[model samples]
Target: MVDIIGHLGMGLIWLAIVSWLAYDGKTALGFVALGAPFSLLPDIDLWLSKAFQTVNHHGVVHTIVFVAAASIVIGAILAKWVVPRFDGDYLVPPAGSSYVYAIGAVFVGGLSHLFADMLSAPDIAPQVEPFWPFVETKIVTVDVFYYNDPVVNWGLFLSGLALAGVIWWQADDDDSAVAA
Candidate 1:
C-alpha cells in the first residue's frame, strides 16, 4: 500500500508512457487527464469497507476483474456523455474507437495503481490478490519500499513529472518540425 502520492505518481508515469506510445500529441494529454482519476479507484475499498463489511482495503476490489468491470461502465459513460462534450481539440476519441480508447485509459490507470500496490503494499497493508477469481493466492510482493517512505513516494512523483515533461517536449519538437 503505497501512499496516495506514490499511487498517483505511478499512474502518471505509466499513463504518460502509454499515451506517448499510443496517441499523438494532440490527444495524449487528454487521455492522461481522463485516466488519472482511475489510478485511485482501487483505494475506494478503503471507504467502501466502512459501509460494507465484505469490502476490505486491498481485498477483492483490488483485483483485475474489478478494474475491468469498472472500466467498462466508465468507458461507456465517457463515450456516450463525456467525449461528445469535448471538441476535436480536446478529448475527442478517434471515430468508431471511442469505447476502446476510453476503456483502455480507465483500465490502464487502475492497473498502474495495482502494480504499485503489488510492489509496496505488503510492507504495511495486507497482501493484494490482483488476479482474484482466477487465482486465489496473493501475488508475491516486492516489498522494497515502505508505505510511507517519503523518498520513494516523492521520487516516483518527480520521475513521473520529468518523464511527462520529456514526452511533451519531444512531441512539441516533432510538431514544430512537421510545421517547418
Candidate 2:
C-alpha cells in the first residue's frame, strides 16, 4: 500500500480540484481537512491485522462495503450540519448534489488509497480485494513501483501542493479584482 503522505496527497488533491471547480480555495481547504483522513481510513486494516491477526492489511476495509457505510454516515453529517452552517455567500451546491459530493469525496478518498496501493508493489501488501464479499478477488495487480518509493510519493505530494497554490493564487486575484 502507499504510505500516509501519498494517500494524503491524493485525497487533498481531489478535494482541491473539486473546491476549485465547485466552490473556492477556502471551502476546498476545509474539505481537505476532512478528506485527508478519509483517504487513510482504509489503512485501518493494518491495525486490525496486527491486533486480531485475522483480517489482513488490504482485506475487508478496502472493499466497497466499508466505503459505502463510512460515506453514508459522514455524508449525512456534512449535509445535516456542516454545509448549512458555513458562512459563505457563494451559492452552496443544491442539497442533493452537495450531499452526493460530500459522500462521494469520502468514498473517493478511500478508493484513492486503494488505487495508490494497486499502482505500486503487489507483493509487499498483497492485492486489495476492492469488490470483496461478492467477487472475492483482487482487482488490481501491477508493478508500477515499490510501495515506499520516495520519488513517486513525494512527486505526488508536490503536485498536490502546486495545485493548491494555484487555487489560492487565483482566489487572491479574484479578491483583488473585486476590491478594485
Candidate 3:
C-alpha cells in the first residue's frame, strides 16, 4: 500500500468521521477535515535524503518517533495558529478556537496514517531513533506488503469514484425534479 493509497482509504474514513461530526455535533466541518491530509505529509521526507532509505522503505520518516513528533508539531501549528488565522473571526463562539478540534482531528489522522503504514510497510520501516532519547536500537522486519498496495488502493480509488458518481447522479435527479 503506497502512502497515498493508505491515506486515501484513511481519507475516506476521515471524511465519514468529519461528516458525522458536522451533522451530529454541530462542530466545524473544516476543522475535522483538516487532519485527514496532514497525515500523509510526513512521507515528504523521502525526497530529502537517500540515507533515509531502507531495505523496504525510506527510513526515518516512517518510524514512530518521527510520526509522534510530526503529529504534535504540525498539529499544534495548524490547530493553534494557522486555522485561526485562516478563519479570521469567523469561528462560532464557545468553540472559542477551532484549534481544539483541528489538533484532535490531526492527531486522529496521524494515528491512522501510522497504523496504515505499519500494516503494509515492506518491513518494519526502520526506527533509526527507536527511543529517540532513551534507546537507539534500529528495528527491522520482513513484512513484504508495501505501505500502499496498488490492488487495494486502486480498488478503493475506484470505489470512491463510483460512490461519487452515484451521489452526483442522485443529486442531479433531485435537481431535475425540483426544476420540473
lDDT of 2 by residue, 94-169 (tens): 4345677667667777777777777773858778777778887665556677778888788777877787777667
**lDDT by residue (tens digit), candidate 3, 1-180:** 245865655654654455454422223344434655765755666665556443234355555666666767776777666666545323221245554556566666655555555455544355233233455543533354665467766765465445434434544554468579
Q: Number of backbone collisions per candidate, in order?
A: 1, 0, 8
Sort the candidates on lDDT, descending order: 1, 2, 3
Give the runs in model 3 whose Cα sits over 4 Å from its true position: 1-3, 18-28, 50-58, 85-97, 123-148, 157-180
For candidate 2, the 10 contiguous residues with the lowest summed lDDT are: 87-96
- Best lDDT goes to which candidate? 1
Superposed model 1: Cα runs more than 4 Å off: 90-92, 174-180
Candidate 2: misplaced stretches above 4 Å?
Answer: 78-98, 178-180
Give the worst 10-residue stretch by lDDT in candidate 1.
Answer: 86-95
User: Would you give me the overall lDDT of model 3?
Assistant: 0.52
Q: Which ten residues in a row have the lowest lDDT in candidate 3?
A: 86-95
User: Order of candidates by TM-score, top first?
Assistant: 1, 2, 3
